[model samples]
Target: MKLKKRIFTILALIAVAIGVGSVCNTPNTAQAKGVPTVFPKNMRGTWYQYYTDGVEKDLSKVKITKTTYILGEYTPKVIHKYIPHDKPDFERADWIFIPGYQKQRGITWLNVKQWNEPAGIGIPDTGDDGEDGGWGENGGEFFNVSKLKGHQVLSIANTIDGTSIHNTSHWYRSVKLAKKLNKRHYKGFLY
Candidate 1:
């Protein structure tokens, strides 16, 4: 009698698990690969550019609400300057990465689509120098931000290059150490 009851309980648990999976209507092995429309809390900050020489430049006074891109939404007419050729189809972007990107290159992938709930449910302070926690912009007039490094910002945009044929990228960071690092390099030259 005891053995029969244990077998029935185990089977019942398995059935419930399968039932829940079906109700969710998502494959058990499903993984989200798209970025969320909302900007993550970690990317907020006034990032100062870190040049190839590792020098921190003047802080950007530009006020921008952090956000992500939904490539299919905007048309060429809207974001014409940002696009390279202004082609009709802009749904897919082309870039190739080596297989096993994280394992081989140690690249951290920020993978998600939409917040589990909407933004502002539970918030934390990132101290982005008055760029307080809020929803990102609907339509941006200028540049588009690509990658971030916690307190730092990394961007590869046509707007930054400005009429140059070649595209360029840069890295910026919010180093809270001092106003300007390497002060000894130049007495009156720094900051």
Candidate 2:
């Protein structure tokens, strides 16, 4: 009995050691703590995006500035799941994100949208009528235009390739190759 007890203890110790020995370190994603007042300098220019771009669709014609990320007249919905509109109602929408950046588990690619793209900002409606009329999509309809996947999160890499801002996404890519590229490392995309 004493021998069996000793063997069990030894096995438990070995299991614990092995469990603590292997740790998977993946490269990543991050969101902002507070609302960023303005855009950064690194991503402050017009970039002709390819299919490999992040969430926003300036339709290859993406313009970035200190305060806004302006999209072109034609933005398709396939690349960005939360666009919410069949067709752009106006020429350009200078949107901003109020919910901050997002990248949860069970999925790859860090993306943000209004009141959740499956999930996003949970800002409850004060009393403005939109699609769901609450913290749902179009939460910014008659309220604020910047809280959706307008891709302000997408334009982020262009803003600070380093750490110019706090809220950020790792989905940014190179439009030149029309292939795919990442300026920021993605640690959140765990497959």
Candidate 3:
């Protein structure tokens, strides 16, 4: 009788284990339902330029123009003029853009004329006069170019200590604008 009781207990435990396994293997119902997808569009065009100088400059004094251009599969060359008030306002450069591929990163290039412009007033205060000299002593600001879309580019940059930095310009789509700038000889491919 004890052996028969043991056999019944083993069968009961095995049945419970099988039932639990089936329940665990069931698929989630939520994932089986459908869902929608959305993709983002690119932003490219001629945009006004703005400079920030902390609290010293008024936000209203910023100047802008609609003369920028977007270069596709070619080099963008341009002559830029800068106005100096509290700081320099413009820079000339070449820009290039390459699209991204599957599992691969995109490509971009920028050749800035005066890549490092100086900052600081001519005075070094009372303590650090020896260590302070105007221009090229502390290095210049940093700039970067990124693809916003097929016909657009975004420039991200910052100053020496990484403050008052912002997006500076947007190039409008113009195939003719690329030719007038005159390429200064560059040999490279963006793949």
Best by TM-score: 2
What TM-score number comes out for model 3?
0.21
Model 3 regions lying over 4 Å from their true place: 1-142, 154-156, 164-167, 175-191
Residue range 100-171, candidate 3, lDDT tens digits: 111112333221223123345322325544433213322222223343434343342322332233223333
Q: Indicate the residue-level lDDT of 119 in model 3.
A: 43
lDDT string, candidate 2, 34-78, tens digits: 534444455456554444346743325555566555555543212
How much is the lDDT of residue 124 in candidate 2?
Answer: 36
Q: Per-prediction TM-score, please?
A: 0.29, 0.30, 0.21
Candidate 1 per-residue C-alpha lDDT over 1-191 given as tens digits, one digit per residue, 9 for 90 to 100: 99999999999999999999897986354245332333345544444432334454543322223443323233212111122222323243221111111111122323221121113222333686553232222111122234432324433222111122112233344444223431212111112
Cα TM-score of candidate 2? 0.30
Ordered by lDDT, highest first, the candidates read 2, 3, 1
List candidate 1 segments past 4 Å from native: 1-34, 50-64, 68-86, 89-104, 109-191
**Top candidate when judged by lDDT against the true structure:** 2
**Model 1 shows how many backbone clashes?**
0
